[model samples]
Structures are given as structure tokens and as C-alpha cells.
Target: MSNFVEFTFRGQPGYSEPTAREVITSSIPVRTIAIYCFDPRAADAAQAVADYFGDEVYPGDLVLDEADRKIGSTATVFPLIVGGGRAADALRSITVSQHLFGIERVVVVHHSFCGATSFTAEGISAAWKHEHHTDISSLYDWDGISIADFEKSLNYDVSLIRNSPGTPKHIEIYGLFYDIGSGELTEVVRDVPAKVA
Candidate 1:
């Protein structure tokens, strides 16, 4: 009944969820998901990951249909920008991306001098309570609210993604620390599922 329904795959006649998913999977060449901070200074994080992999394509050209309608892309890396590049906020996206694009790798990049390092979980909670008169200390995991150490944060995030049920067991997960000033990435943690015998 809604006008937007016509824009959705389910709204089309002869629409099948499985068929639509297959089409989407074949259309995009996405093999990696890059999760990084929303900071403007760290915008090149995705490209850096692609370069690190040496086989990925970032910002690849778009493919168009006969009618010039944009349909697909040659990009292999999809960037999922978020605050602090926390895995807590990227779990759902990882799930959906795996469902549709069948990603082979998920990279989490935490940048140097990020705003997330500026405040503690308790500090944010207390500030929210004083300013908005709302208690949110228990609403989120305290450890994920801010970054204390890059190695610890990266390791925690990589473990979180690996342990998530929605994340495919076969996929590789990596945690990297990006230096904003130097434009360099340092691998802090890498979680690759052991190959089955």
C-alpha cells in the first residue's frame, strides 16, 4: 500500500527472497567488509585495508545496465563507518553483508587519537545523566564505549566478531590500528578459523 513498497525487492511481481539474494550476491564482487571510525581524517582506512590485502578492489567502478541504470559494482571492499569503529555497532551489518554479499573477510580498524579515546564509559554515562536526566550506564557494554588501549580494544573487537553467531565461522577477522598522522596500519589481532582437516 505504501509508495516505497514498489521500490523494494519484495514488492515486485514474481519476487522471491532467495532469488533476490542470489542476484545481489552475483552482482557485487564484495569480498571484504572494512569497519572504521567515522572521523574524516581516517577516511582512507578502507583503501588502506584493500591495499594491505593486495587482492581487493576499493572504490571500484560501477556497472550499469543497458538503459544506463546503475546495477552493480566491481568493488570488493565495502566500508562500514561507525563511531570508534566498534564491533558492537557493526555486528548487524556484518550479518546482513554476509547474508547478501558473502564476505570473506571483516577488517576492524581503530585509529590513533580517535575521539573514542577522549572519554571514559563512566564519564559519558555521568554526563548523559547530568545533561539529559537519563541513566544509560547499563544500556551498553562499558568496555566497548571507549578505547583505553589499541591492542586490547582491537583484540576485544576481533573476538567479539568471531564469537558472534551471525558471523560466518569460515570468514577471517582482522583488527588493525591506523595512525591518522602517518597513514599506516598495524595489525594488532588476526583471527582466522583453523582449516578443517
Candidate 2:
């Protein structure tokens, strides 16, 4: 297989390239699918896990445990797709990946004080009207796009994935609330285990 995987960042107005490819390394294992927001404030959970657990399990450049033996077969990460769920296109891409990959589990992480919450319905509609010069007011709702409350939004998105036909019934989905102030990850949905072993 090619070393690089194709990716399309949808609904990002400022993103220069419409699509890009990310190179995959032989290390990180693909046991779980972690869905984190594109916010830079949140820590990289995959990297943290790899760092704390030692490279024998999730090998990294700094991990030195049995480095020689773990060289080519060392632990690494699987394909991770990060984007804002507020956009319709992003949600579609996420669902499509779930359908095709059939990943065992998914962890949806929502952080406090997100940028998506800043966008209002009036602003979005005005932007659309300005760009397309047409009245699409009835097509989209601002309330749906905004993320005023992280916990509520997290639950809604979790439910959305659970109910989505694209995601398999066997796939376990989870919701996480990240407090940016204190740097903590709290599980919003307790019915299923969200932590990665």
C-alpha cells in the first residue's frame, strides 16, 4: 500500500488545499478510532498514550524500550480523522469512514469554549446569502450549527453517530468533555467504557 492516505478537509473556508494526503507510519497500532475536535487547545491523546505507556505498546521516536527489536514492528497510530462536526461535510466524512473501516470503537471528544459556538444562525445565513446570492434561509438552521454547550452538543453528536445508518451497530461510540482550563478529559457517556486500554 502507498505510504500516504488521502484526506479531504471539508467546510474549512480558510484551508488552502481542498484535499491532502497524510503519510502513515508502520508503528502505532490501530485498535481504536479516536475522534477529537480540531481545536489546538486540546492535547493529542494518541501521542500522550504513546508517551506514557512506553513505545513497546505505542512506539514513538523518544521511546527507547527494546528499540532494536521494535524498529520496524514498533507501535504506532492508526488513521485519525479530525474535524469540526458543526459542518455537514465533516459529519458525512466521519460517517463514511465508520461505515467502511468498521472500527471497534469511537471516542468523540468535545472541548470547552469551542469556536463553533461563536457562529450564530444569522451570521451563517448572512454569509451564505452573501456568497451564493440566494435565499437558503429555510435550508439550514443556525441553532443546529452552533455549539453553545459542550456537554449537550457532545451527547447529541454521540447519539447522532449511534443512530446513523453508516455506523455499524456493533461499533461502540463514546463522548468526552475536555475542560480547556484545567486540561482534563471527562466521560459524558458512562454506559460504555471510553478509556483506551
Which numbered prediction scores highest in TM-score against the true structure? 1
TM-score of 2: 0.58
lDDT tens string, model 1, 91-139?
9999999999999999999999999999999899999999999999899
lDDT for each of the candidates? 0.95, 0.54
Overall local distance difference test of candidate 1: 0.95
Span of ten consecutive residues with least summed lDDT in model 2: 18-27
Task: Mark the 10 consecutive residues where model 1 has the least summed lDDT.
Answer: 137-146
**CA-only RMSD, every prediction:** 0.8, 9.9
**CA lDDT, candidate 2, residue 19:** 27
lDDT of 2: 0.54
What clash pairs does model 1 have?
none
Q: Which residue ranges in model 1 land beyond 4 Å of their true spot?
A: none
Pairs clashing within candidate 2: 27-75, 27-76, 28-75, 28-76, 28-77, 29-76
